[model samples]
Target: MTLDTDPGVAPQEEKLEMAADLTAAKEVAATDIPPELVAQSFGGYLRAWMARIRSGDSGVLPVLLGLIGITIVFEIISPNNVFLNTGNLVNLFQQSAVFMVLGMAEIFVLLLGEIDLSVGYVGAVGGAIAIQLVQPVTINLPWWLAIAFALVVCALIGAGMGFLITRLRLPSFVVTLAGYLIFNGVLLIILLLGPFSGYPTLCTSSCSGAQNNSHIIYQLMWGTIDPTVSWIGLAVIVALFGGSMWWRDSKRRRSGLVAPPPSLTFLKIALIAVIGVVLLLICNANRGRGVVQVVGVPWVIPIVLALLVVWMVLLERTRFGRYVYAVGGNPEAARRAGVNVNRVRTLAFALCSATAGIAGLLYAANQGGLSNNVNGGQLVLYAVAAAVIGGTSLFGGRGRALHGVLGGLVIGAIYNGLYLLGLAAQYQFIATGIVLLVAVTVDALSRRGAATGARA
Candidate 1:
């Protein structure tokens, strides 16, 4: 019998055709799947987030929960429940700003699996330069110019340190340690030998230490924007935040990629709005003494927020950011991928110092002036604690600007609450040490779990 006419041959050809058709049908079905349906509801979002947490991607959940716990505990322990008072909250924000900025500075280097010990004194030097330039007895440059000069000098200093690390293969820890001492001495010399030394009136005694009370620098922290302007600015911020999030999700969905649920997006926006409104209301309240009324949000809050936004964008939405993660996660792989590991590290260090400079200015503003006695060493330690506590891994490749803010708030709350309860500095130190240890422990455990899961 001819093959074409054979019954077995015909059956085999039919089976082959059927299998091809089935595969084609499956391809069509997959293409037709709607991406939005993947996470379109609140339940779906929650489930997805739970999965992520299980995978050791907890993000800010721990920090947020810890903050809540701290707040409640403090409120319960305080005699008058002053921990949650509006005025006290305002002060908490002011206190947190310095730490937040410093924590952010540390994040830049920490993200590269490196550390910058010099940020504290680097910042002091920046502030000293700015104050010296703008002081009446000194060069008396424009306030803005003074600030510009300060930032430039700090940036250059950072860049130079970066060059040495990248070109000579020096350890960042050692370089910055040397910087810590050098800048500390430099700060003292600036205060004692220059115009600051001659101006007896400028150097005033304060509780913390000796300070140079520069009117311009002091106002930067204490000054307030108009209430109307603050409201308008806040509205704009909320709108932008919501709109950006919505746009991102929409784009992902349109591209047939999984996006966060709409419900989750709205929840996030609502939470942000509530927080902003509450902050505005508290700041708008007259928290002044018996005769004077201090109203409106302090200028420093917006400045900090702006910097946070800028850094977030730089980290999340830029080529440099991707490179940073790559280098942090695996420097060898990054090198093979054509990433200039040295340049990235160098720039990271520079950025870290520049951020420290900004923090120094805020510190000076808060203290009423730059002081020779400013403890950069202690501040650097706090910055590291803040970043680590906020969820940034010491091993690098995982962190955000938001971590700094959240962590700084936690540290600030502890300090503020203790002061309110009349607790000694020793208690604050012990409490902070415990918190840092817990955070580090959690980080190590989570990383280990992630590694195990991957291996499996």
Candidate 2:
């Protein structure tokens, strides 16, 4: 059969069109056209599509930018040059590390839509035990051994709470309440057994600013890292932050999905590096009164960063993490999906309690020692505030370890800035309360928005 073509169409043009059609067919067969090419081909027309995909997302970018803005604004306005000083800057991390741990602990129960009113006391009891185990008047165990023992004890306690809640079908509220009372008693017993030894304060003076009259546990926990941070330590942090972003983006690309722009990713890396270097430089800036220069990264800094990474990986990369979200989203559906809901919940509790124990120890260290006056209640409230203020939800199923860090940073900034401003304790407390309330309200509103979008 003779074929007649349009008079205006050349043979070359017909061949080019045929080639394009075949390429389109191949793309349809494979699916997922190269994102970069798709973007380029669509040009600005993909803006609506990109926006749709990123809708309701709560990654770290907004928080980071907001923090930068706040820091700059505060620096510009504050008198006495306190906001830009190196000492105060390093102090920010020192201040926030405890809350980071506490926030992380809360994330577990929060994810499960449960609450742990006892974590603070549980951690307090653990720290008390640690000190008692190592005090000259008590067991006199090695410091390292004491810390390990404290962690294990706390983990078991958390497990016990989980068991009580799951096996007995008791609400988390009731179980944790009983735990709070029991642990508070335990704290008293430990304190009485070994009265605040001077050794702790003496040990922590070199590490955290904690007073020596507190328990030796705190001194040992936060007192080891000097203000003089090392280049090696800074390098490790840079590597970690870089590695995380690279791996995450690579995985996303391998999964045949669009990745964030390379420029955006590199900008994140640069921001982290800048923060690390600035932190190191500030800590190393001779701000001490004595002839001896106190500089070097605090041990707590790396510890908190490490914990942040571990928790982030657990939440973002693991099947357990997805299960956590699933349980939060629809517990009944998760159960029907054959998820080991109780097991996951129990494990989460154990992890949360153990982390809290670690944080308590750090808190004690920052003080250079634990004291009978250690306000476990107030500390727990601050921790919760840090988490929510950083953007973790009180209602659950909407948080990340990074949020804890951000939230903790915000809390720390408030404390440091307010202290510099010579604000009273009452004012500080009120300000923190307000910030936390606002954060929770925002979280609830965000959840509602997500629901609305899903329905629509």
Q: Report, for every candidate in turn, its global Cα lDDT versus the true structure.
A: 0.80, 0.70
Error of 2 at 317 (Å): 2.3
| Distance from true location, Cα of 167 in model 2, Å | 1.9
Taking the candidates one at a time, how many backbone clashes does each contain?
0, 20
Question: Taking the tens digit of each residue's C-alpha lDDT, what string does model 1 give over 304-407?
Answer: 88899899889878999888888888999999999999999988888888899899888888877766669999899889999989889999898888888888
What's the TM-score of each model vs. the native?
Answer: 0.88, 0.81
Off by over 4 Å in 2: 1-54, 61-66, 69-79, 195-202, 205-229, 236-255
Encode model 2's per-residue lDDT on 365-452: one tens digit a residue.
7765555676667767877776776667777677777777887787777777777777878877877787777677767766676566
Residues forming the 10-long window of minimal summed lDDT in candidate 2 = 1-10
Give the TM-score (vs. native) of candidate 2: 0.81
RMSD of each: 10.6, 10.0
